[model samples]
Target: MRLRRALLVSCAALALAASALAQGWLDRVPPEIHGEVPARAPAGEPLTVRFSASEPVAYTLAYGGETWEAVVQNLFVLRVRPGEHALVVTATDGAGNETRVAYTVTGVGAPAAELHVTERARAGDPVSVRVTLPEPPAEVVSVRLGGEALPTFAADAVEGGAGRSVVALGAVPLSAAGTLDVEVVVRDPFGRERTLKRALEVAAEARPVQELGLTPEALGALSDENREAEAAALREAYRGAAPDPLWREPFILPTEGVNTSAFGLPRRYAVSGAVSFHQGADIAAPQGTPIVATNDGVVLLTGFYPIKGGLTVIDHGGGVSSLYFHQAVMVVTPGQRVRRGERIGEVGSTGLATGPHLHWEMRVNAVPTDPLAWVGRLLP
Candidate 1:
């Protein structure tokens, strides 16, 4: 009889515990809330709304008497009409417990932005895009020309204004011609996006060419086997598009010689078949003439090659690089830090050259431009 009484008391305790567990289930598990209030939107513009919950939830997102429902709430966007409106996000769990989040949306004037191109870019010429933002900063700014993504770099504004970003659209080809279109994409902090299109008329100009008499034997002797790999390596090494000018001062010529040849004139090496551009100014100099650094930079490449001969490449940063080829002897090592007017090598005709001349080339983002343009001035 005592045993039976004890068993009955234990059963009663279990029933009470199960009753309390059933009653407290809703209190134990509740909906969680996260995410920020969106930025200001334009009048009559759609306001983008986003929020998150810990679990699957039923949500009622309301703004100005207009309501939207989400059976499962994680990421969603809702458009609301412009003007000041209170946005209420109510998330309910399976147990009917609700978590409410509120934010004030003040729809003011649309966020203003503009794009300015510094110059009319030629084919194979470097182009820059500058964007100006509204008083309230945007979350992100993007630019594109000819349907290609242009990488942008942020910079401080000159004359003390809002921040600006400069994107270096490296060396577009003549193929991107005619009515060129630049697409600017801007997104505010509130997930509202504004797209603007700017049309630029590009001029059609043919790249110049030159003819050279080179025998087939001479051309084949220039190590044609590894030429592509070497060229690719050099291009990859100097492909950086830095925002700030790596060179603080104007560039000075490396050697004392008359410019016998200029950049961009593609030399037809064979009678009718092979054509390659002369990327540098071929300045006639003595084989032992000292070759100096054009400006302050890090020596990225220094070695003898079949085409460039004894070559030395100095990276002046900001996508500007200088190349001195056909050196008799290289004084500096690769990765060496060099200064303006410092002797880095001696001019020579060690590789595919007619005589002793320093082939000095100035490249911006690996596209060869006139070295003289960069000499005695600040430029690409």
Candidate 2:
């Protein structure tokens, strides 16, 4: 009789537990919103929306005066329209419990122009590229021309609220006629919505500059031995690999002196009016003038040369490098560490220079950019 009583007690406990489990099932499941959809309209060109949820929920999405019954909440993408939109989401649990939430949709402006890219000019020639937009967004993050991503530019009040950026290729040779594709991306401040796409076209080639040749007699002035040694030194200085960071610090002037020649200046040598371009700036200073390092850098080169005189080149972490020419003496040797403003040399005309001065050149990925624009503004 006692055994029968114990058996009855166990059966009663199991039934009670089953009833409790069914009652508390909803408590274990929390509210989830996973489905995402583009709040912007299809007129915005690149707008898309997405959606997600924890489990299958009987739901409906209301937008643009239309309702969509959502059998299962996975990912639903929508192309929306311009102007304000009301989003109503209704969800019902398996147990018949129901919930709803609302959000707003702000339409994106139409593309003012397709992202357009054309060869404006050539290296050493003036290049102009035109970008057309259907309707300009409030701001432009950046426009990629060719294969390069340039700085973000802002629009003026008159530019249809669209912005532009221009670059000078300057004296660099191209492998061949090139095709360029431009990509422009605009973002809406709300909801981190962004539109990105590319525009492609063949670039119009600029007229090639005629090459001026000098006879062997004219080149006799420079000693072949001296020129070979100088070439070897420069090659050694540049052959090593350097990292090109995604972001770079603004350049700084290595030293202060009188600016004698600006970059890209057409020049006539020996009163013949035979033109040449000044590739770097000449900063004339007194002999023994302290030549400081431009930024924190490692000395890649410290040597004397027949063409450059006594020169030093500093590799500043990034692909950026600075060259200081016409030094009377070099204080730092190759492989030495130097800080910004650290004296690396004394200025003197040692190479093919007219006077005591420092020829300073700033190179980005081996390409020359405007040094003044980087040096003039005091760094923050």
Candidate 3:
């Protein structure tokens, strides 16, 4: 009995020691959020810290004299001053055991304006210019493009502490070419002033919608059942969440014609007070107009879709894509390679359309943006 008791005591003591040793203090907190600073981040932007652990626990993080807490599977967004800083996150389990990890923070200034140009946009292509601010309160106290005050943001009052702002530049007119100047007026947090100017090269090209064809019968069918099928196909093609840092490059209009419907304009489909936002621009061109590829890309889909009629989807690099719909003919097939200005199909009012017009649309990483913004001067 004495021997058995001694053995039991020894086993218990060993087990307790092993349990204490297994409670890894260092392993409690992850190394990434606790250790090194990210290589790049916008200056004065919020610092997002992710805390993850297998066990359910609460955590308290401290950085730059600010303390924050995170519940299980929760993230904390913290703001830090510019330059280098330190961060620490502590985790306490249900047993009151605590562990901590530390990290460094390095601040970087916002990205400078880059000249985004495209070779395919023609005179009537819809365009949009958006400027992203580097810090919160992303409001532009003052802004200008080409010595002209661009009407992008609301100029009435500033809200939050938006230290940053974005101004979307409008489109150039059809047949507009030459050097366009862009200027931006900025006011800093201390009420200081700064100006940014850039000269852009505008190359003129003929839009392809000039050759698209349409018929009245095709238009009637397009405005009916075909419309729903086309929308469903598009939604299916983009089933998952979109990629980050969507394409910001200039886009070339896919078809050529006089723009009939404008982007962001309200469309009253019925006289009974039903209205919807115009998502894309409609180019009123002749039937059988040859649709052209807007940029260099590979064909993602090609088939006689239920709603799109004959549709061709081209995937441009960097998660950017352009879709040509309601074609009278499908010249390209799925998985085909195409270059800018290449022939894809002839436009028709095959699917759901009110008339024989080419419905042109542009998407950046699946987000709908103004197509004319890439095509030259639509906005004066």
Each prediction's RMSD over C-alphas, in Å, is 9.1, 10.4, 16.1
Model 3 over residues 1-380: C-alpha lDDT tens digits?
99999999999987876776577432333322333346445557776767675566678878778887655544777775666677777777755557787777755444333223233343333333444455423235444433545445421112223423343434434334775555665554434445566655666543322222334454355464667766676666654322221222334667778888765455554333344555567888888887888766677777776446677877754334677766788788766778878889887876656566766666654545456665643221
lDDT assessment of candidate 1: 0.72
Arranged by TM-score, best first: 1, 2, 3
Predicted model with the maximum TM-score? 1
- Per-residue lDDT tens digits of candidate 2, residues 144-185? 555565433222212333344222122122321454445555
lDDT of each: 0.72, 0.58, 0.57
* Residue 286, candidate 3: C-alpha displacement in angstroms: 1.4
Report the C-alpha lDDT of model 1 over 45-94, residue by residue, as the tens digit. 55456677886678888887887786575555556456678888899876
* Model number with the top lDDT: 1
Worst 10 residues of 2 by lDDT: 167-176
